[model samples]
Target: GAGVSQSPRYKVAKRGQDVALRCDPISGHVSLFWYQQALGQGPEFLTYFQNEAQLDKSGLPSDRFFAERPEGSVSTLKIQRTQQEDSAVYLCASSVLRVNTEAFFGQGTRLTVV
Candidate 1:
């Protein structure tokens, strides 16, 4: 894909269930990021990766939330023990290695927790 790609555009999970979201970034893209967006709100950074190394994950809400870019190209986000408050749109973005570069976003995965 030329840009970021996310799977399972929509998902429904029962409360207390866990969910996993996948992201495939552009080939050779050195930077990848995960963001969470609540209804009517802007996306908030959740994690970042530089190649296979996770640079930062301070934005994750809890220890139950996890993200990884094992091979530097594909990333995954896992949410454990889902709650109604965890329902939101998860967005993935990728950009070049340099600073101030524009990021390309995927369509995002919308999770609705019942």
Candidate 2:
């Protein structure tokens, strides 16, 4: 019954450095989603994966953002050439699959680019 978790609850980066954040979803979860939440804004979907297959990635801001789930369980989101505009709470969620399900969120990896 492990819940989702993210590392480095906080991160501060330079204006153009790359950073990789990690996410560990609940065991046995088949669907995982990544979202970016700006200050006072609702979480916006960044990408989704079912098992090891990436099902959607339309919300990724730009080519500078990338994500992957190779083993169907653990995943990572990498941001390249970080910008002040990229500063936000990166959240990871997971649910059972194929229907309406509740998504559990982590404390989030808060990235700040200065």
Candidate 3:
């Protein structure tokens, strides 16, 4: 894909359910980031992956949230035991360089916990 791609643009999960969102970044991109955005707010950093290694995950809210980029090109963000407070748009971005560089963002997966 020429741009970042995210699957199931919208997801509805019941409270306590688990949801997995997928992100396919531009091929060969070296940096991938996951962010959570609440309504009308800017994206909040969740995790960052440089290739297959996870360098930063301090922004993850709880143990229930996880992200991985196994082969480096594609990544997944999983939320377990979803709560109503977890409802938000999960954004994925990729850049050729490290943090602070220009990045391309996916449309995001809007998860609604009801």
Top candidate by lDDT: 3
lDDT of 2 by residue, 4-87 (tens): 999989999999999999999999899999999999999999999999999899999999999999999999999999999999
**Residue 94 miss distance in model 1 (angstroms):** 0.5
Superposed Cα deviation of residue 50, candidate 3 (Å): 0.2
| Candidate order, lDDT descending | 3, 2, 1
Candidate scoring better on lDDT of 1 and 2: 2
Q: State the C-alpha lDDT per candidate.
A: 0.93, 0.94, 0.95
Off by over 4 Å in 2: none
- Return whichever of 2 and 3 wins on TM-score: 3
lDDT of 1 by residue, 1-114 (tens): 577899989999999999999999989889999999999999999999999999989999999899988988999999999999999999999988636998989999999999
Listed in order, each prediction's TM-score against the native is: 0.96, 0.97, 0.98
Candidate 3, lDDT over the whole model: 0.95
Q: Which residues of candidate 3, in runs, are more than 4 Å off?
A: none
TM-score of 2: 0.97
Instruction: Please give the distance, in angstroms, between residue 29's alpha carbon in candidate 1 and its true position after superposition.
Output: 0.3
